[model samples]
Target: MKRDLELLKVILSKVEQQPQGAPFITNKDFSTRDPSLVAAHIQLLCDKHYVIAAQNGDDKWSISRITFDGYDYLDLLRESTLT
Candidate 1:
């Protein structure tokens, strides 16, 4: 599947909104989008070091927190939306 930048932003925003160290489980969250799609993007995020995630036995990812790079990217995304 193609990369969805908007979904990436949404995922980062959701992860950022969570309390520090809180785990954002892919299967439990993001009901509005396809589970597989979300999982794929989350894997991409983890691969890019944008977020710290752990893979569960069920093949779903749990995001613990956003990295500094993640925050930087998110900020840029938010800024772009303002224009």
Candidate 2:
């Protein structure tokens, strides 16, 4: 769970740095046999308010926008990266 959460942070950071209406494929391929883990990581990001998760009528997740709070958090992480 710890590793998954860390990965989620990185993924969200990447998306946040991109344009507003960018398309991010949360699931890359059909071989993603572990849906539970992926969902958990996405939930963690949602709980932390890093990213917005929207489910269309087709049960597919759509990432809308990354909040300003997320950018602020990323900036703090950037400071640590320099050290």
Candidate 3:
């Protein structure tokens, strides 16, 4: 779960540096070998209101943006890790 959260943080940071609604491709370099687990992580993010995920009919996913709550959560995580 910790690794998943870290991966999500990385993904969010990358998306933040890009334009709004920019398409993000999930690949070997961008995700874990277990995509099903990653999908679960995304679902949790959505439930927590941290991010919004869109899935096309063909099953492609793109993150729209991160909410303020997401940033706050990540910041708290970072502080804990540093301490």
What do the candidate models score in CA lDDT, each in turn? 0.83, 0.58, 0.61
**Which ranges in model 3 have alpha carbons more than 4 Å from their true place?**
1-3, 24-29, 57-60
Clashing pairs in 2: none
Write one digit per residue (lDDT tens) for candidate 2, span 1-83. 55453555565666676675667645332134354555566566668887777654342455666677777766666666432
Taking all chains together, each candidate's TM-score versus the true structure is: 0.85, 0.59, 0.64
lDDT of 1 by residue, 1-83 (tens): 99988888999999888886665656459888988788888889989899988888554878888899999989888788642
Better of 2 and 3 by TM-score: 3
Candidate 3 root-mean-square deviation in Å:
3.6
Best-fitting candidate, measured by lDDT? 1
Error of model 2, residue 8, in angstroms: 2.8
Greater TM-score among 1 and 3 belongs to: 1
Best by TM-score: 1
- In the order shown, the candidates' Cα RMSDs to the true structure are 2.4, 4.4, 3.6
| Model 2 TM | 0.59
Q: Candidate 1, 51: how far from true, in Å? A: 0.2
